[model samples]
Target: MAKDISVPFSYTKDGIYYFERRVPRDLQKHYSASKIAYSLRTRSSSVAASRATRAAQQLDEYWYHLRIKGSELPGKHLLRMQQNATKAPGSLLPSEHDDNATVSQSEAVAIYLRLKGQNRPVTFHRAAERACGYVIDVCGDKDLLGYSKADATRFRDAFIERKLTGSSITRIFGTVRSVVNLAASEVGVNITNPFTGVYYDRQSGVIERAPLPADVIKAVQRECMKIDDDLRWLVALISDTGLRLAEAAGLLREDLVVDADIPHVVVREHPWRRLKTCTSARVVPLTGMSL
Candidate 1:
């Protein structure tokens, strides 16, 4: 047998050619072994080289797909049903007597929004829509009951491929689970949400923020008090009350209650801005240079 540069495999003394390639680090978890190895069963170098080239090309295409499975699909939202201004809850769901009916991923999004989006902010609706849209983009709009645990795992892997922060992916999964759960219950279908229990590293690639040290905060506050200008006032206010930048920036004039026994600023939802969480809507007493 002649040595062929085109042959990317090893050979044994018995003249059997074998193919072996290491699995990429990111995709290692999908396989039980670190490397894929197989016997080509060809003693002819020409045949072995041809076989190796084809196998390598196939693997390249597969790995490329795996890396970009979560990429945004153009016009994925088109798959969704158009919103009905007067549709009642469960209107979009399949009929109770229609045992043959199946709810698709798009229908689930519409059903969830119609039922849960009442009086909710636009962000709420968009979040649900975007999350479900990802499913349709990556896995097609399959019937709700058609999803298996493997599909859920694939969805998770797609998010990883997209480089979404763990927290962001977790929120996406939460929204998807809610949509599927609501759709299943409203349609009187007995099905479990496939998005549940799909584990991804919740803190992977997350850079934790550390709070400012007491001395640093004090120094900054001291500088703010010395300047006491409009710009510094904003910084001082945040330093004292710990209000988020948006929360403080969007505060209403009426939110300031200086005449009260304990002067405080009301942090509540506004049309221009919404509280980060329900508990974020509260009153914080003004103190230090904030007064």
Candidate 2:
């Protein structure tokens, strides 16, 4: 005997209906079945019920088809329907819009992830996330994808007032621009790229001064020698080689190359590894002091 499910629809303005279904516990994780249920809740009753019936039928047709093919249906069809309902001509019938009025913020984030994929680096992703958070905090449930140029300008002013550095401001604005661009493309909203004409003051560049003066270096070295011989060697290595503090800290025992004819240190992908450019990867010839 085939199991029966009860789907409920509620009536409201314009004679439209909203739906809910009593799904079987055993099929809770079934992609097609869950998708159908999710669809029914957002679509107009007649359409929702029809799609639900089709999805349920498809579920029984072939297990692999339902699992693999059905997963695509929710993202493509259901999400599209929800997007349409939001921008549908005229106000959606109360029942039609009730459960589908605003796209969930989580949905926006999911779309952002799909847009970013693996194309963006971790730093870019982090910056985008920070911008998204600011948008959500300021706009609440409002759709940031639909924000106007004026809105973006307001955000920029607010960010500046918070005393963020020019570089930091640029990074945050860049993230906002990417999210808005992707959101506009995916959600069919026309949004202005806030960072398009924006400019931040670039402060005078400061040169990185070498670590300590000779007197301070000697004093520190003398202090280190009295405390621990290992620390003394570490201080000597940095003072002699001009390696960055982090690179020195992260150096491993295996990174020490004592057999080279020129006796240079090999920094090829070491624990303390930051090369300014491809040209920075060459060996640094050791002096008698470094040895």
Please list the residue runs of candidate 2 whose C-alpha ends up more than 4 Å from where it truly belongs after superposition.
1-127, 139-145, 178-192, 204-211, 229-232, 268-282, 287-291
lDDT of 1 by residue, 32-141 (tens): 46776665657778888876776667557656765687211112232223343244444566777889676878777777776788878878977987888678656767
Worst 10 residues of 2 by lDDT: 72-81
Q: For this target, which candidate reaches the highest TM-score against the unseen true structure? A: 1
**Which tens-of-lDDT digit does each residue in 1-291 have in candidate 2?**
111233333222333333334334544443334533222223255554564455455434434443555422222112221333334422212234344333333345446655564545555545555566565444432445445566666767766676676766777777666656665556554555654776556342324567577888777766766776776788777777876655666667666777888776765555335544446555666664466
What lDDT does each candidate get? 0.76, 0.51
Candidate 1 regions exceeding 4 Å error are: 1-91, 226-228
Best by lDDT: 1
Poorest 10 consecutive residues of model 1 by lDDT? 70-79
Write down the TM-score for model 2: 0.46
Residue pairs with colliding backbones in model 2 are none
